[model samples]
Target: MPKSVWFLIIGMLVNTTGNSFLWPLNAIYMHDYLGKTLAMAGFVLMLNSAAGVLGNLLGGFLFDKIGGYKAIMLGIFLTVVSLIGLTQWHEWPHYVWLLTLLGFSGGIVFPSMFALAGTAWPEGGRKAFNAIYLAQNVGVAVGPALAGIVAEKGFDNVFEVNLWMYVLFFFIALLTFKRFETDSVVPKNVVSERKRITNKASLYALLIISSSSVLCWIAYSQWSATISSYTQDLGLSLKQYSLLWTINGLLIVAAQPLIAPLVKRWENNLKRQLVFGVVIIAISFGIVAFASDFKMFAAAMVVLTFGEMFYTPALPTIANQLAPKGRQGFYQGILNSATTVGRMIGPLFGGIMVDQFGMMALMSILVIIVVIAVIPCLVYDRPLVKRSKSTTVLE
Candidate 1:
């Protein structure tokens, strides 16, 4: 990787670390400290995620118009302001407003970071995105662990720590981010590009994969929302709950070598890999439904991480493969938007289930959803197969 890509990766690491400190604990703080119901916490998270979705689009626009350096710097500045306010006043509506602001600002930072990574190392292809992904997991691993320890003192300390991490990120971006010579060009002629959708089979496949991605994200988002609070109700330590995330993030980074052979075996069989993942994830949820101890939950987390290892990357890879030459951005956007929609809905959905039907019912429903989601992976390419056969007959 280029040095420029490394800087972007480092910036991403810092940015995600700062944000992770609060996100994993958001529901816990709201439900336990503020006495808000789980459903209410979910509503707040949905609002935050919706704000983030908007910010994501705006950030990409800014990156095209003003280049990544300016866009990212602007995002970092706004986030700093939000965090300062959060540190000062985090009660009721104030916390809600500040958290939403942080989400929007932080969202603005991300697309620029990922886009910058790609622009900086266009030759690196998926490696650039993978590097950024790895950095994010690393941040997730480090942030929540530290947050749990700091939260043992007070959540105020956690907020302060979050602020400092962003402050450090700001400095790093100020000194290092401007070095890249990125091309800032606005996307144009969408109407002209619409005519290029001659590959209907691929388009359908991408749509199917995108739909599955939404459910996958919804299932995954439970960890931070309902599951976080669930662990607390069982008398688990905050550190224990956060450690699940730590294990999750670390395994994503550290277990690559361990799964390399299996990954290589299924390199061309993405659908198979995805089906296996969905099954593994369903199994994990089944374990969680019966889990009564921290160790049991930790084991579930490990299994969940392994499941995501297949499901997460495969979705994007499939979208990328399905995309036509002039429509890569559009296809990727569909996948990303679906994931965001899932995140936006997941907390609220999970919270409602737990509130209405209880944890057992919630877990049962999630497992069923995961099991059903495999149908898309299995059949996403059927149309492609049909088209290939027809074209062969014609030739």
Candidate 2:
């Protein structure tokens, strides 16, 4: 890996660490602390995710036009300003407004980061993405543990800690990324010619894969949304819920070394890997449907973490691989947008389902959604493969 990639990973760690403090607590804070209902909390989260959708699109465009360094810095500045405001006015409508702003700003950072990682260490293949994913889990592992402790004192302290983490993140970006460039690994002319031949197939594959990505996120999001609330209904405390995330993060971080060799065995078979991961995720939700205690929830989380470990890194790598030259940022943006869309809808969808139906129905529906998502994953590569065969026959 290049020095730039290392710096990028470290920056991701700081970025996610800061975000972890707020995200896990968002629904709980809104419902329990702010005297809002679960549905209202879901609505606020939907607004936040909607802002992120815009940010993802805009940030990717900026990365392509201005380059990663400037785009990322711009995002960091917006997020920092939002965080500062949140620290002071974290009450009612003010909290909603500030969180939406924070979501938009934070959204801008991710597409640029993933685009940079793809460009920075193209030769590193999936390792580059895995490193970033690992860094993310490290933040997840550290942030929630500390956040639970801080929140026990006061929710205000949680906001304060998050604000400082972003402050550190801003400095790190300023110091390390000032000289970063967004040049393609392949030459521009070569990429242009290749695009003329491969554009249609690539676009089709991206769309299919992106559809699957959306479904995965919708189901995955329950952990932070309705599932969090459900645990409280079952007599769990905030700290206990935080510990679930902590366990998730630790498992992701700790299990990577053991899991890497197995993954390598299927390194070239990403489609199969995705299907397997998605199936595991579906099963995990099924487990959640039956969970009544913290131990059962922990078990479900562990299963969910394993599924994520397999799926998370591959999605971005696939997007990067299918991207055509200068459009890398654009394709990556689409991928982010898909996840954002799922997130935008997931909370409200889950909240309504749980409220109107019940937890059993919500979990069961998620399982079915994930299972249906597998069809696209299995077929997304067919177009590319057929195209390759025809080209071979012509030659």
Candidate 3:
């Protein structure tokens, strides 16, 4: 791997660690600490996700126009500002405002980062994204475990730690990522990339692929939303719930080596790979519906991680393939925006189901949602009929 990618990986690890400290705990803090109902907490989170959607779109556009260095730094600066505010004021209205700001800032950073990674290493293909994904999970593993320990003292410590990690991440990117952005020497596969499709067809393909992405996140976000409450209601402590994510992170890191051969076999057929992942996630949610113990919830998380290992990296890879000469960042932004839409609606949806119908109903619907994602994955590429050159079609 290139040193630039390594820096990006390192930056991503730190960035995600900071994010993990708050995200996994957000709903819990809203409900338990701040005296809000689950529905209200979900509504606030919905607003946060809405901001993230806008940020994702704007960030991708900025990356294409201004270059990744400036765009990413802008995002980091804003994110740092949000964290500073969060560290000082964490009461109800203040927390909600800062968290939403964090979402927007964080959203701006991600597509730029992913686009840079893909740009830095187009030849590396899935390898580049896989590494970034691994870094994120490693942060996920480490962040929440440390957060659990810190929260044993107080939630205020969690905010401070999160702020410091983002600060470290900001400095790391400031120092290293600029060189990477200026030094993008790898040639793009322009002829092959533009051979078979129109920009409109490609954009439609992305939207189709993103539909599955959205659905998968709806099911996946439950682990952070209703499932957290469900586990606590069943007598698990905060530490134990945090440990579940630690296990998820560690499992994703360790299981990659074992899952590689299967991924390699499905390398040419991303749709097949995605189908396998979605099915496994559906099965995992099925397990969650019946789970009553920490071990069972842990088992569900393990299964969930396995599914995403196949599912997550492919979305960005597909976007890279579909992107035209100058739209890689924009395409990546669309993919991220889809996932944000899922995350945005998921909590409120889950909260409603749990509040009215109960836990079993919530779990059942999650499994169905996961299963439904496969349809889009299968059909997203159908409209592309090979042509001599890239054409801009009105359709």
Reference-based TM-score, model 1? 0.88
How many steric clashes between backbone atoms does each model show?
Answer: 0, 0, 0
Q: Each model's TM-score? A: 0.88, 0.95, 0.94
Error of 1 at 355 (Å): 1.3
lDDT of 1 by residue, 164-243 (tens): 99999999999998988476564474633223333677888888887787787788888999999999999999999989
Report per-prediction Cα RMSD to one decimal.
3.2, 2.1, 3.2
Give candidate 1 regions above 4 Å deviation. 184-195, 198-207, 318-334, 379-395
Across 1-395, the per-residue lDDT of candidate 2 in tens digits comes to 79999999999999999999989889988878898877888889989999998999888888888788888999999999998999999999999999999889988989889989988888988988888888898898888888888998999999999999999999999999876667533344544434455877887898899999889889988888899888988999888999998898889988988788879988999987888889999999999999999999999999999998988889999989998777777788888988988888899999899889999999999999999988988999887987687666656
Q: Residue by residue across 1-395, what tens digits does model 3's lDDT show?
A: 99889999999999999899989888888888998878888888888898999999988988888888888899999999998898899997999899899889988999999999999988999999999999999999999999988887999999999989988998998899989784332245555444434777788889999999999988888888888878878999999999999998899999988999999999999889899988999999999999999999998999889999999998899999998767888999999999999999999999999999998998888888888899998999866653323344412
Instruction: Rank candidates by lDDT, best first.
Output: 3, 2, 1
Q: Give the TM-score of candidate 3.
A: 0.94
